[model samples]
Target: MIGQRRHFQVAHRPRNDDESILPLINIVFLLLIFFMVAGQLSAVDPFEVEPVESAVDGQPGPDEFMVIVGTEGRLAVNQDETDLEGMARLVAEHLQRHGDAARVRVKADGRAEAVEVVGILERLREAGVERIDLLTVPET
Candidate 1:
């Protein structure tokens, strides 16, 4: 048989481009989803408001309501921009909704006036916010 006219043929299957790249595509999609979900974990401020420096570092609770105050007197509650009265109204509404268990945190720009910040705290107090925590960056 070897010396005679015996033909040996190897069967080869065509490669599918899509099948070769399936794992890569899956990994890309997984990475995309991971970043999308991770990006929304933290609340973003509406404007530029650098936190003041503090001697201690602290982490905010997930359920805490955030109030951002910019250097130009801009105010935002939970990333929604509002005026002082509007902020006060929102705080009151939040207090009514969450009652005494509501947690409030204020993140103010380092350059913001102390009087303005104090006034905001006073307004919050009037709005029935019993405890307010000020967010700050730890000194390096």
Candidate 2:
């Protein structure tokens, strides 16, 4: 009887070429940092000019005009400062140009006096402005 010998070959795993992932990860991190550094945050509207509150919340129509009153009695129409008489004229012109449907929104500083706000409101009334709104920030 002859003795039989058998040999078996084991296959080794192929080497991975995945070292490129490290550079890709580094590039991704760098791009993430660049975007974060380049991104800009919009400036917040001044808190000193806190607006008056309203019971109703909804989108304003296009005919609406914004009037801002500061604590120092400064008056602004659509963010542009104007005198009392000028404001009246401006409001009148706007109403005349935009028609009777025009609305007015008053944003007054929290510390502003009632008289100042009332004066502006009166002027607006005289200008034929019917729909008036007092702007305010919701309590957080």
Q: By TM-score, who's the top model here? A: 1
The residue pairs found clashing in candidate 2 are 52-136
Candidate 1 local lDDT, 89-131, one digit each (tens):
8888888899988779999999999999999988888788988
TM-score each candidate: 0.80, 0.61
* Decoy 1 TM-score against native: 0.80
- lDDT measured at residue 67 in model 1 versus the true structure, 0 to 100: 91
Local accuracy of candidate 2 as per-residue lDDT tens digits, 60-133:
44445778788888877765777788888888888887786777888788789999899888888877998888
lDDT for residue 58 in candidate 1, whole number 0-100? 98
The local distance difference test score of model 2 is 0.76
Error of 2 at 29 (Å): 14
Stretches of candidate 1 above 4 Å error?
Answer: 1-19
